[model samples]
Target: MSLKILDQLSQDFTQLLENSYDYNVVIEVGKQPNIKLYKAHSAILYQRSLYFRQKLTNATKKNNVIEFKIPNLSVQTFDIIIRYIYSGIVSLENFEAATIFDLLIDLNEFQFIELVERIQAYLLIIMLLGFHPSMIFNSDDFKTLQENAFIALLKQDDLQMEESEIWDKVILWGKARTPDLPSNLEVWTDENFKSLKATLQHCLPHIRYFQIPSEDVLKKIKPYHNILEKNIWDDILAKYLAPNVPIASLILPPRKKATVQLPSRKASIITPSSSIITLEHIAELSSWIDRRSKIYNTTEIPYEFKLLLRGSRDGFTVLKIDSTNEILGGYNLLIWKVPNGKYSERATTADSFIFSLKNRNQSILSRVKDESTAIVYGKISQGPIFGNGLGMGRRSKSISKEWYSSETVYEKPIRNIDAWFFIDEYEVFQICKI
Candidate 1:
C-alpha cells in the first residue's frame, strides 16, 4: 500500500498511546482478541511499532528515518508529532512552545529537516511564523530555546538556508526578551533598526513592505532612508515600482548633454589631368554647365567628340564647339571609339575647296521660263572620290542641262551660283552647253 496509508496506521497507534493512561490495552492477533500483553509497556511497544512503520514508510518515500517525539508529552504536542508521523500533517498546536523548538532541533538532528521545514511553512501559512513580542515575552524558556535554535541555524554549514528562513528567525529573535530590549519601550530603538536593516537587506525582495507600514510610519523613516541605497533595496523597489514611473527616474541623477565637433575644411589643388575632383576648386569656378539632355534637369554633358589635333592628351587646353558655332574653353570633348571597321573624319576649312557657276544671258533666262520646266545636272569626270570604288570605268554618269522658257516667265531664272566641294581626285564633266 501507499506510504501515506502506512503513516496513517502508525499515527492511529500513536494516538492510541497518547489517549490511554496505560499500555495494557489488548490487540487482536489474527482472530484472537485477548493476547497477553508483552513485558514492555504498551505505550513503548506501540511507540516501537509506530517507529518501524514510519521507518518503512520513510524508506519508501526516499526520506531519512522518521523522528518520533518522546512519549508522555503534553497532549497537544503529542498530537502534533503523532499527526506529523501518521499523515505528514503539519499541526499548529504548541507552535509557541519552547519544547516544540527542541523537537524541531531533534528532528533536524535525525535528518528529518523536511518535517521542520514543513512546520515552518505551515506556520508561515497561518501568519504565525513572524516574530511577535507578545508571544515570546510571556515565556522565557521558549525565548531561550528560540535563541538556541537561531544559533544552531546560524552555525549550519550545509543547509543552504533560504533568506526567508533567516528573516523569519531574525523576526523571532527580535521579538524575544533580552536586556537590550527595554520593558517600557513603545518604539523600536537604533539597535532594532540596525538588526532589521541587516535582515531586510537579505530578504528585501521577498518582503511585502506596503502591507506592514503606514504612510505615517514611512514618513518617520524618511530621515533614516539611506538604507534604501543598498543594492538589495534598490532591486526590490525597482521590481515593485509602478509601471508609469521608472525606478531609475526616482533614484538616478538627471542626464546631461554632450558636445560634438564638426570636421574642418582643408585646401588641396587638383590638376586637369587628375581623376579626383576637389570641392574647393569646383566652388571657385565662375561658370558651370552640364550638357546631358536626356534627364529633365540634369547638367551632365552627353555628347562625345574628339579634338582635331594629334598628341592632344591635355584635356584642359582643348576647345569645345557649341551648337551656336561659338567656341568655349576648358574641359575636352571626350570621344568613344566607333565600333566595327567604320570610320568618320572631321570637316575643316583646310580640307575643303570652293567652286562657282554663272548664267550670262537674260534672254536665255526668259526663254528658259517659257518651257515651264528646267532640269540642271552635272557629273564628275574623275573616278569615285568620296567613297571606295570597284574600278575607274564604273564612275557615276553625267546629267543634261535643259530649261522650259514658259516656266520662267515670272522672273529671270539664270543666275550665277557657287558650288563647294572637298575633292580628293574627282574632276568635273559638262554634258550640255546652254
Candidate 2:
C-alpha cells in the first residue's frame, strides 16, 4: 500500500514540471483570469519554444542580439504556479502582486496605451495598500517616460483623439494629480499672458508685419518711451528689448560729481596776545631748538627748558612784578650748597644768588677764588624777563664763553658777595671774585 502511494506522488510531481509555464506567464494568468485557454497555451508552448531557440542562437553568434528576459520570479509564487499547472489550484497569498506603475512604464514604451490605462487603474489598488500615489509621477525620469507614453498614445487611432486632452483627463482621474494643477481657469489665463509676453519678446524681430495690434507687433515698434524716462527704466527696457532698431532712442541723464574741499592751515594756528607768548614765537623757539639740538647732538635745550616753561600740575612757584618794581608772592627760589671748607658762611648766600642766575643761563659756572675747579648751575624761564641785574653788573658776561674760549679772562664787575637779588621777575643775580 505504501509503495503504491509513493509511486502516485512521484508521477504527480513529474506532471507538475511538464505542465508548468514560465514565472512571467504565471503572473499574467493571475492578472487576467478570463484569459482564453488557447492563448495561454500558445504563450507557454509555442512562444517559449521560440524564445529559447532565439536565446540559444544568440549565445553562439559573435554579434549577439540582446534578448529581453523577464525579472526573477518570487520563490513562493513560482512553487504555487507550478503546482497549479499540475493540480489546477488557485492560491492568493502565493501569487505575485502586480505593480501598476512598472506595467505603465513598460506599456508606454511599447506603444500600448490601453494597457497603460488598465495599469493606471491597478495603481489605485496599490494606493489602498498604503503605497504612495505620487510614486508613479515623482520619478526623476518621469518627464521622459511621460513623453514616450504621450507619443505612443498619439500614434493609435482610438487614443489619438484624446492626445490634446490627456493632461486634463489624467488630472481628473487621479486625486494626487488634481491638486497639483491650477485651481481655476484664471490662473491658467495669467500663465498664458506671461508666456505670451516672453514669446512676443522672442519673436518680435522675426515678425515682419501684422494687421492686428498684437503684443508682438507693439513691442517691436518700441512703445516704452513713457516708461523709460528714468535711467533705471532704460536698464529694464534693454534687458527685454528686441534686437531690431528701436522706434526711439532713450536719452540718458548725466551723473553728478561730488565736490570736496580740503581743510585750511589758518584754522590750526592759535592766535596770540601782545602780553603773552605768541604761538608763532613758541613755534619758532621749538623749531630753533630742534635744529640746534640735532646739529649739536644735544637734547639739553628742550629738555631743560621744558621743566619751567611748561607748567606742572604740582603748583610751581612764579615771581610776579608790578610796574612799581615791587615783587609778588610767586617767586621760586631753588638753593644749592657751596662745597664744604671751600667758602665762608657768607659764601652760601653768594652761591644761592649764583644758583638763581643759573635759572636764566643753563651753562653758568663759578670758581672759588683762583681754584681750577668750578660748580655749574642751570636756569629756565617760563616767560620773558623785564628788568636788569641786581647784585651782579649788567656787563657781566656768561661763564659759558670763558669755558668755551678756554681762558679765565673776566671783564665784568664783581659786586657784593653776600646775598641773592632779583634782576627781573623771571631772572636772579649773584657775585663772585674769581
Predicted model with the maximum lDDT: 1
lDDT, candidates in the order shown: 0.30, 0.28
Candidate 1 segments exceeding 4 Å error: 1-196, 199-204, 210-214, 223-229, 232-243, 248-434
What lDDT tens digits, residue by residue, belong to model 2 across residues 238-294? Answer: 434643535344322222222211233233433321222324333333333333332
lDDT of 1 at 109: 33
In the range 128-173, model 1's lDDT, one tens digit per residue, is 2122223433355544543334333333222232333343444545
Quote each prediction's TM-score.
0.19, 0.14
* Candidate with maximal TM-score: 1
Clashes of 1: 15
- Which pairs clash inside model 2? 318-330, 319-330, 358-378, 358-379, 359-379
Model 1: C-alpha RMSD to truth? 46.9
The worst-scoring run of ten residues by lDDT in candidate 2 lies at: 396-405
CA lDDT, candidate 2, residue 96: 22
